[model samples]
Target: MDHDAISIDGGTAADRHARPGAAGAGGANDLLAHFSDPHSVARYAEGPPRFVPGFTDLHRMTRLLLTERAPDDARVLVLGAGGGLELKAFAEAEPHWTFDGVDPAAEMLGLAGRTLGPLAARVRLHQGYIDDAPEGPFDAATCLLTLHFLAPDERRRTAAEIRRRLKPGAPFVAAHSSFPQDDGERALWLSRYAAFAVASGADPDQARTARAAIDTRLNLLSPAHDEAILRDAGFSNVSLFYAAFTWRGWVAYA
Candidate 1:
């Protein structure tokens, strides 16, 4: 199956706000609207769920942690857990681990609960941004795809928060869609895609504007920068475990 084309089972608020013309009157409002959209659930329910190859790396990372018996008794935090598909997988794979999923989108959380049903009971769902996440010292944490929505500073702050919430030697995995390292390639693709988006009837200007907005709102940390952020956050051992085109994944020990 085409995993990349397979959408998550639920839609978070961010999906709606990002839709053309549905954006709210202001920046914060637009952000909030997109973050709260409930369509993510519908998308997931429409078909069988499967992890993208990149996400499989996340599962592998978790498995490695389990093999090493990294704080299995500690509470797990899934930042931007979306519809809880990963939570379901983790819960099933390691029932000994309890989970607390935090996402700013209510619709996404609701979908997560519905998708997992009784299994979902093991998770404590929180509706809030990763930056504003409640108290932690979690045994481990995972943030996927969602990081692409923040700017540099926000990404740093969020990483710092994740670090603070982790127990010593705890594992933290953060993934994002990276910009191409080669300046020429990056510029060429952006120029080509910008034209393609416009040719496809999307407002080229709006699309460009939205791209900037996303860059400002999300932190699509480059592989090198991502490692640096983790190391700076006090994570001792950090390395990139996976990459697929723009998407990259990291595994770190706090």
Candidate 2:
């Protein structure tokens, strides 16, 4: 199946991580603390049916987006490259594509280093945010399941930073969790997500806990809100290519 052409139904998926914290500081501290554990990093790299909810398909969507939008020899910027899943996949898909994998966590970068294996040398792993990443007028970039951790201001900052790093007319693909505008829709969406967790292997209590964390911690935005943020950050011709309940994916020109 050309997963790229597959239309989303009601099914949804997300990149799972523990909440960052109050303001952005709390989240940064939480991330640093979370990446401190080797076991945690290992579990995260393993994907669903073992460690957390999302895995293969989410990364697959990212891959599909890049394949469709990025040039064959694209210089790609992978933001928040926890385990290098997208980096490895992209390198394998288009061997000529060089990558810069950026993440603030050393252990996660280390896991990414291991995941990249032979391609490790091809990818330049940076232990920082987009600002600390190597200078790049990259051909394309991806920030999947990473931005929802940022506060609104931080998200704008991130968007602007990414815009600064990419060449004009470059394609940037991103996926994030979103909330509904209507109270009824919001309740229904949350309930469906909680049920998806159970179906994806979480116990009911575990699902509830996960749902609570998402509701209380993650900085999910509505689709319109996301488009506004992108446009305000300087991306033009922004268009959403995929949607599955709370999870949304878009491609915008930098």
Candidate 3:
């Protein structure tokens, strides 16, 4: 059997090909470490259900994207593509759509490589920032669960780069961490997210630490801020399709 092909039963294609005692093989710690490296697969798995309240946001976003535009044979760009979940889902839906997946984190890219399996070859992986991605006037693009990690300037720069790579009138989907403009609304949302994180199997202390890190480092913007940044980056008709707590998904045209 091809090790690159995922099994319908369980385990990744890489898992099936694993030899005994392979380096970084076996146990939940090793798996967790891999999933939580520079980027995080674990957060994606838990964030929507626990912090955001809607468990099906990603699925709904992808479905809406496909429904709006089939992406058949389209050259799609996946910015900050973690663990390849978006790539796998999109590819499965539109078999002819080719993807350029870019991420700065090595471990995340490795996870994506495994997750993609045989479909790996269909996606050209760039282990760097979006600007470093190969030439592309892509047909469409998706930047999911990213963006808010960057500061205001970097976010603007990245969005500009995305626009530069896409053809005129091309569609782009972006989902990011956000907060309500009102102070009370923001406080309430953050409190709920913290509580939800603890309830969703995260250690309370660790969750608090994570939240602090986000508060200090990540530039979680408001909905208006995001729209302004995108519009300045040359996108038009920025419309929200999904909104759950701090997570918001929008579709824009280049």
Candidate 4:
């Protein structure tokens, strides 16, 4: 299956299979260490739904947007696909669709394999960052709940790489930590994010810790800046498709 992946050896594909400075898998040492733990990987499924508003809906909406322009037997590229929640959801929604999922967290990828079960046959789990992804003219792609892990520069490079791998006009759906960039507004929204998590039954202390990690460790940006990065990466007709409190999702065409 590795033979199916294209070898893009240009300057664009930086750091051979090395993890980026992303949050969960690629951010602070403590956080990345957390992700690498078998215990944390075992409990990964519980965190997103609690911290991210409408986690299930996010997957559904991603499938819908991707299928808007994707073929029935679409070959999709999924970045930061460590948990396999979205992969499982997408696979269940469209049996014919195949996926190439990339992430730096080996343990999380193992958990993804378990989460996928029999569905793993339809997906190739690449253990690396976006640049390590298959150089495909994929039917569609998604980078959900992952970009905030990367700094703005790395984020832009990653987006451009995803664009380059896509078929012309292919839809690329991305969702991450995008909120008001102002100092006061950022703090306010982060507080609300923590409140939402607590409201959703997250332990208050854990929620506070997660909120703090997001604020200090994740490289967040404004929705407008996020859109600009996509546009700068050569994506067209970018539009916001989901806005659940601190998170924002957008669908763009490559």
Tell me each candidate's TM-score: 0.71, 0.81, 0.78, 0.90
Per-residue lDDT tens digits of candidate 1, residues 1-254?
11122223334455544544222234544555554555635664332212233454566665566336356565888887766777787887776778878776666676777766667657777666664465687888888766656555556667788888888888887776665646576555445444544554556675586456543444344577767777776777787776654557778877
RMSD of each: 8.1, 8.9, 8.8, 4.6
Per-model clash counts, in order, read 18, 2, 0, 5
lDDT per residue (tens digit) for residues 1-254 in model 2 = 12122111111111123323212546444545566477878777533332223555666666776667677788888887867777787787788898888776666777777777777657877766666666688888889777877777778788888988998888888887766857688768877778876776667896786677667666767888988899999999888877766677788888
Model 4 per-residue lDDT tens digits across residues 1-254:
12223211112223322343433334454565577778988899999999999999999999999989999999999998888899999999999999999877777777778788778889888867776688998999999988877777778888999999999999999999999979699999999999999999999999999989888877788999999999998899999999999999999999
lDDT of each: 0.63, 0.71, 0.69, 0.84
User: Measured by TM-score, how close is model 1 to the native structure?
Assistant: 0.71
Q: How accurate is candidate 3 locally (lDDT)?
A: 0.69
Candidate order, lDDT descending: 4, 2, 3, 1
| Clashes by residue pair, model 4 | 21-26, 22-26, 22-27, 22-149, 23-149
Better model by TM-score: candidate 2 vs candidate 4: 4
Better candidate number, 1 or 4, judged by TM-score: 4
For model 3, state the Cα shift of residue 84 in Å: 1.1
lDDT of 2: 0.71
